[model samples]
Target: MYHKKMKSKVVRITCIGLSILTLAFVSILIYSFYGSKKTIQPDALLHQYMANINDGKYEEMYTLLSEQSQAIVSQEDFILKNQKIYEGIEGKNLTIKITKIDELGKTQILVSYDTYMDTLAGDISFSNEAYFTKNDNKEYRLLWQPQLIFPMLNPDDKVRVNTLKAERGDILDRNGEVIVGKGIASSIGLVPGKMSDSKELDIARVSELLDIPVDHINKALNATYVKDDTFVPLKKIPKDQQELEEALLEVPGIKISDIAVRVYPFGEKTSHLTGYIQNINAEELKKLKEQNYNANSIIGKSGLEKIFEDRIRAIDGYEIIVVDSSGEKKETLAKMSPKDGETLKLTIDAQIQSVLYDQFREDKSCSVAINPKTGEVLALVSTPTFDSNDFVLGMSTDKWNVLNADTNKPLFNRFKVALCPGSCFKPIIGAIGLTTEVIKPSDNYESSGLSWQKDGSWGEYKVTTLKEYGDQVNLQNALVYSDNIYFAKAALNIGGDLLAEQLTNIGFQETIPFELGMYPSSFSNTGTFDTEIQLADSGYGQAQILINPLHMASIYSAFVNDGNMIKPYLIYKESTVPEYWKEQVFTKEAAQIVRNDLIQVIENGTGSDAKIDSLTLAGKTGTAEIKQSKDDHEGTELGWFSLFTVDEHTENPILVITMVEDVKERGGSHYVIQKVKTVFEKR
Candidate 1:
């Protein structure tokens, strides 16, 4: 019985020994699997290394490299190389992916990856290969090489930016004439490096040929920053002046090239309408960067140039090139072609514009003419004009300052502002009286050379008529005689509030919807009449009233266009459909009656001096008084003549408005009459 019990104890000890052996085998397999995933696999090591690169963790990426790679590239060198490549790739997105991994040998692994990047050139994809070597500690490490960044990257490779310049579009007139264009011009200059003649003698000879001051030539040649290789421009010459160019070439150190310049065939005549372009300043660059503008770009500075900037601006292109460290070109990675801007065509009659400009050459005046039926602005003239080519070609600081300080205001656009309308506004009151049923066409009022009005709310005032018109006149005869006393009483009967509302409805104190900037017509009275004198004075266009020439011309255009005032436009591209007032400003019947009275004014009244042959003309004459000094009571006057003519051959009326300032000395109505007549006769 003792022997049997000992055998059972031996059996239990053997079972326990087998259980411990099985557990030991399972633990060894678990350890082997964990080590392979964490350190043995090349993909795991490569992924960790690339993660650091993606995060811009250069120092960490350097630590993951093999010992041999660390010997070849220092951490500082690695960081600098990567940073330069990253900076050159501006506006690009980068992403990385492990493509493939293969076991090469007992201690080496081949790793393949793809870099997907979005560059300005376009979406780009390329693959690269890396080898991870296992160290004595059984840890895999990445082998560093420049090709790891890009499959085609070389040790000496660098980046270069090439700008592809775009050509600006041309501006054309209605007759298909080139108003503004990129023309060939020669700049007379000297390359200091190539100059072998005496510096002083050469400068003297150059100054003589170019018709420039000797001091200017000396200053440019002796400038501190003027390098030996620098090309110093003395003056600009026309490319076609071969004789003058040959004469200048006799002087040593002279150089010339056919460079691009903004040329205007009719410079000063179309300056205000065509505008000009100039190199953008720092302040302008900041606001235009989003539009792909560069610091070296030129842009429109004023007038139509500023209004249609985007359409005329060029779209620049670029090329991404790979170069060596010494700035040697290696390969072109990507390229983009430049796109030229759209051509802009205008509705300007260059011949008519030139005539109007010639007539107003000596006077400080504003004149505008439009086709009443179509709202095609044929001519817009403002006197004391500046040569726009001066701004574009390059103006001296002194000359620019002189232009700004000129009393005549050569740079100021006169048609854009408001001025007193004088008796020219009488038609507006007549229209209001007729449309609002304030008076009938046959209504007559007793009038003399003068009349007086006294209001309880305001004070007493007097309105005097022109010496020509007598008493007891109807609307037609009153307009022909310009009877102020008659119109004043009519305005008082119509009330100021109604008159102000009518003016507002016709675009007073409101935007005129023109391409060029325009100031709104303005008046003080918004609601009710302050006094009968105020209404009467306003009715005659003498009570703090201001109206732009364009606005007045448009209003009268409605009278000729069957009570429809089409919006004025200059660009043909944007004016496909005619835009006019939604609500009619006058009835067709009222317009006809007013039109007949205007005809009488030209036929037998104040505007008779402006009569022309072969046409039935209609118009109004005005003389707005302006106090010379605020303290002085006596003032000069601004003479105005607004007229339109209709011929049997034409369906549209040719309308014009001319304003001549300081007209008392300049021959009031007669001066404006001759000016308008000269333009029409030229037409």
Candidate 2:
């Protein structure tokens, strides 16, 4: 009886325990399917909405709005407002963080967030609240408002931008005189009140004088801003166009007024150096949009204006204001003060520049003058140039077409370009020979006539010299005579490998140490001299040896500067000093030997035409043939003359190198020598 009672009690206890386990499993399944969703929906929906705003997806944001918010503001209006306020300020690099989410009620929630973005005016960071609500559809939606775009924004408020333009800096010379400065320009326009009875006749005459089309003037006259007494500006002309001003005044309806403009006082004389400013094109505007540039901004288009643009360009300031419906300022969101551009002073002498240009204005020529002792650039001139004022005021298509079609290439900049140096390069080889000790100053070579080849295997190839000065020639006589055969034999003595090594060590086929960009003086096109004939020809600057006009002048400084080439510069600073470009280029003894011979070259040799009674000069003259081969006769010739003042009495000593095209029948180097002599004598 006792065992049966114990078994019944155990069975009851087991049944009660199984019932409790079953109930717990059912409760967990209910929570997983429905309870958890209610807790996660609001936060996930809020996160997705915030992500949409950061990505600039305004349409998706509109879809996320609550029903009442959607009805109050239509989708199109919301999208436009978002796009304008976002893009108008040029916003970028956006980031948003949700700081907290709190429940206001079962259907409404308040979310705290921080927003940050970069704008054109400056950076913006703010904290705001996002209200989210659940509707009858049981889905969370945003409660949108103008405050969502900006915390302080309202329905009638406008995002206004105010720009304060900076004044462009002037470009000055070494003496602090302006090369480009603020000057007056004439505004050519029409006065409706002064129109004559024959208005068409007057308009046609004005149009012809100003080179503006008839339709352009008509459009300006018919503009909505035009009035019976208003001056309808048609075009701008140089202030000094007195002849045109007189002609236009005769046309009854024409009126002239003065306006401020960036003027080039030297006009075409310094156009290649100062360059010119013009309206910024589409490509430049797009590239510089981030720097506060607009369609109305003026930018440098060429020359120094283009090269040193960052230093001369103005820093335009901006203000972002919150304006009312009546266009009254309510608040300023961001502000920056206008900063003017900095001035650029150069080591240019305006007097020397003017002199060089005026002498070569009618010829295809290039000139570079520098202080050999200081390496300060005195003058740079390229002739047959177009006026920079034309570019500044305005340019007609016909005028541009004429300049482009001209065979002389007036638009091209010739200073930085490289050309064959001809016999003028003999001094460099002589210096190299002296440095290598392969050719002594008195070592003599038997003359091999005007032309000779290295060996019999080479056919129809020969190295030639201008004149055979002596039967037995040494280094000094070879340089003065520009004897190609002697240097050719000297180069053979140095061998092909050591000659190239020495040339490269002296900065051949390398970037010049100058602020201005220039093509390097190189030994050959392929960077190596392949044949003995080619190497021999290269010794006298014939076989693929080309040198920039500026660099050629710089190279001569080594002789006078204690065997160190001074680094050349254009822009001048107060603390700037003469720095060495290449040291130990030649021994001090070798330099003196070459220098003495150059003085004799001016006094008694080929360059005697450059002699003057009042001043002593040392120089070299060369005539380079632009032919396919040594004997090709149809090709044109280039005349070159490089000279420097050698006397101790000279005050402002200068080394001037000039080259002119098409001197074949015009006396060759003699023509250039006389021209250079005239320049010195005039000064």
Candidate 3:
């Protein structure tokens, strides 16, 4: 009986143990199942969302979302946002492949699709990848924002937030006053796609309202809107009159958008330095697209604008609007706030620039002022200038043609393009003679009003003499009298190649690399000659050698700053990129010697016309020959003058270079000198 009881107990205990083991296994399985169900898988959501999108069931794809997601987004927004994608994939077979599944439960879907547009034809195709996430409810939805796919398209929903459109950074003078400002303008815009019936649109009404000819409006409308479905501007109407209001009311198809027009209050006075901005054209748009730039944006056309474009252009903000199948906005989904560009503080002094402009207006000439000590350009003035405001508002074709046709070439920046350095080249020769030891302070050559060739082939070239020095004149007197013979002798001693090399080192033969584009002036060697004729001509600033007025001014600056070769700069500071401002170039001694000699020229030589009372001035004058093919006055010379003045305290010297083309009508050097004197007198 005892043995039977023990066996029963053992059997019962074994049964209990097996039962416990089975229960533990079942519990583990239940826990695992629930845990997996609770976890949200973004990849699953992405797959489902992509599948729905491919099927054109935007509402179904949008509904599979968490409460937070649903509250933030709407069905109409989803449809509108995906409309562009659908359009892009229209008429082409699309293959959606899941490329990457990450630990965040997000899946990247690669969409291979083709598109057709007026600009792009022949079934253009490209592959784009997007990411999506799965919610806890086991629903998959797109995780990537719509902007990633259709960057140019509007968002589906409007974000309800007070957001400011950041303004582009101000262009300020050294004093921190705004050179370019925002103002309200009468803007005429047209929705090429929106205008259904061209007959219903009153071209006459638009012309009357905008104060333009009816024919002009009709032509623009036909050219821009007749064949394309896009927004095109007929013109930016000037708000100087009240007709804009009357036009907006009468023109049903015309829309007036508040546009921020850039204004230069100082007008033409700052035109050369500040440059101008204009609407992007088709060519510009194509280039911008290649550069990954916004199609509808303004860009710098010249001067500082071109130099600091990256720093001054603001990051454009975006609005998300949901659109429908027909490409109509339903609602806004999200928005990105724009950031303003950094302000640029230019080294330009408006006051000085104004003074220089007025000074050059007396004659059809241009001048450039550079800070010899630092290579900073103070003022660049090109006279006979047009209002830069014309460029800001998009100049009329008539005005552009007139400016282009003007004999003075008012559109040309004379300081950068026109070259006539004449006697101004003498200083460079002097420097070369001094540096090469070809002519010492003690060395003297006879200036009998002429220097003759050793071969006696060419008759002696006449040189003006202040005094008869018995066939011997020192460097001081040679410079003072502007003696061609003395310089010729010096040039022969130094050799033409060496002279060219020296002149090049002091800023000649190449374009002055300022913030503006410059034309490279010519420099040629006096064909390997045994005589000093070519050298003498080059020494007196003539012959095949040429240089721009701005370059001449910079070379003079090198003289004033004591031999420091500094690269001319216009921009002082940019908030966006600080690295550009850190560049330093120039030496002080080299600039000073040149400066001292220039001062002596103003005080005692040909540049005496430039002297101002109480100011220690230095200058040189040149009458450069212009070949006949250049203009009507082929034989007439261009007057050139460059000078720098030491203020009363002698702390900072101001350098200026002026070039007057075809100045023979006004007495060449004599006339130019008087103009320089007038400027100094005003100072």
Give me the candidate number with maximum lDDT.
Answer: 2
Q: Count clashes in each candidate, considering only residues at least 3 apart in sequence or on different chains.
A: 1, 0, 42
What lDDT is reached at residue 291 by model 3? 44
For candidate 1, lDDT tens digit of each residue in 502-611? 77888888888788888888765454457666677777787767898888888887777667666887776554455675247888877778998899899998899878
For residues 356-458, could you state the per-residue lDDT of candidate 3 as single tens digits?
A: 7876774567888766656667788888888877887767666788999998877777766747577677777776676666766667665555434545555
Between candidates 2 and 3, name the one with more favorable lDDT: 2
Q: What is candidate 3's local distance difference test score?
A: 0.63
List, residue by residue over 1-683, the lDDT tens digit for candidate 2: 88998999888998888888888888889878766666435556666766776688989978889999999999999999988888787777777788898999789998888888777678878888888888786778889899887788889998987887788888888888788878999988999888999988888888899998888888888899888899998888987789989999998878899988899888887899888999889999999987778788889988888888888888788888888889888888777778888888889888788888877888899999888877888888998898998888888878999999999999988887899888788888888889889878989898888988788877877877778876668887887887888878888888889888988887888899786678888888788889888788878777788998888877888878767776788887776466878888888888778888898899888899888988878888888878997678899888889999866568877889999888899988778887787768877
Model 2 Cα displacement at 149 (Å)? Answer: 3.0
RMSD of each: 7.9, 7.4, 14.0
Question: Which candidate wins on TM-score?
Answer: 2
Each candidate: what lDDT?
0.79, 0.84, 0.63
Range of the 10 consecutive residues with the lowest summed lDDT in candidate 2: 34-43
TM-scores of the models, in the given order?
0.81, 0.84, 0.67
Misplaced by over 4 Å in model 1 are 1-91, 95-125, 129-150, 155-159, 194-230, 233-251, 322-332, 454-460, 525-531, 573-578, 628-634
Runs in model 2 deviating more than 4 A are 1-56, 66-76, 99-112, 129-144, 187-206, 214-234, 245-260, 279-299, 446-472, 647-650
Which rank order by lDDT, best down to worst? 2, 1, 3
